[model samples]
Target: MDTAGLEILGEEECLRLLADVPVGRIVYIDRALPAIQPVNFVVHGQSVVIRTAARSRLAIAATGTVVAFEVDEFNDNCVRHGWSVVAVGRAGQVTDDQELASVRQRGLRPWAPGTREYYLRVDIEIISGRRLRHADAPAGP
Candidate 1:
């Protein structure tokens, strides 16, 4: 047998869950259309940092705008609990080469091959999250 659904977890649990995962989804508005993409990120202080190719959508999305990031996980037994944290804030490219290089040094590699000529640093503003523990999640956090 198998079961699947979303459960809302507590705030502490949400942060803990966030630290356990390295990948998340970043949602942004593009020309009035909503776009979402999975990305590898590091939670730096209150912000999320991700590396991207020079001309990729991720890079384009980071041009002085706010974006959303979500990460969640489930158990193998199909009985699982997970949470999603959304960071709504302004996005920008990390201009300092030294800082960018340091992120590379931290072992955050890109899934896409070839030269990753750009990196994005998203400063979180509204940090709200929700956890999925059962079938019905209230109104979210």
Candidate 2:
């Protein structure tokens, strides 16, 4: 079997990509308006963790919300294809002291400056991934 010029990553590879990336775009709705924001996140166990301010939009939008967490990587030369991992899940505040302690021990830090007082855990309901290549055509002309 010869695999060449083909880009197909296994589930483990996708998980590796997810674990390696620190920042992703989170998709949610605010008052029926679509929104996407770059967020700092960590993949813990089978879920995704995010730290935000107590009153920030992400913290508010994530409370009891079903959202999308997406991460991807690409190169300018395009010789190496990029992969995307999308996690669809419900977001909620992380209140368990033990869990919070464990998360803190993992060295997960907030991207924004100052004290990030809110922590959210997104229980992953569905996880899927796709690959992108320079050869792929744009959706529209």
Candidate 3:
């Protein structure tokens, strides 16, 4: 397939790109509807960790369920070129004392100013990414 000239990224490259970005969107169900919300995250082990308030929609929907997380970077100054990585996995609340301590050590504080004490972890079971090249970037074989 032509793939519309997008470059398909490998798993390692996808994870690297994910780790390079600080913010991503979490896709989950809210009130029985699909929703997306921006969040600050960190790559720990083979999972993505997110911090949020106890009662937030994400906190409520993320626990013990499957969700999708995505990150992207683009340059629009002169050309519209970017790369996006999407990760899908089962998410669960981080309740173990040791794991909690470790994630806290990562210094992943909430971007939004408020009391956010809950930590959610999503295991990166399936990950894929694609790159949109500038007009000049070669479509390498």
Best model number under lDDT: 3
Comparison by lDDT, 1 against 3, better one: 3
27-126: candidate 3 lDDT, tens digit per residue: 9987789999999998999999999999988999778889999998876553457788999999999999999999999999888888999899999999
Q: What's the best-to-worst order under TM-score?
A: 3, 2, 1
Q: Write candidate 2's Cα lDDT for 74-109 as tens digits.
A: 654563556678889998898999999988887778
Superposed by TM-score, candidate 2 places the C-alpha of residue 82 at a distance from the truth, in angstroms, of: 1.7
lDDT at 2, model 1: 19
Lowest lDDT block of 10, candidate 2: 132-141
What alpha-carbon RMSD in Å does predicted model 1 have with respect to the real structure? 6.0
Model 3 whole-model lDDT (C-alpha atoms): 0.89
Comparison by TM-score, 1 against 3, better one = 3
Q: Please state every model's RMSD to the true fold in angstroms.
A: 6.0, 6.0, 2.6
Number of backbone collisions per candidate, in order?
A: 6, 0, 0
CA deviation > 4 Å runs, candidate 2:
1-10, 134-141
lDDT of 1 at 65: 82
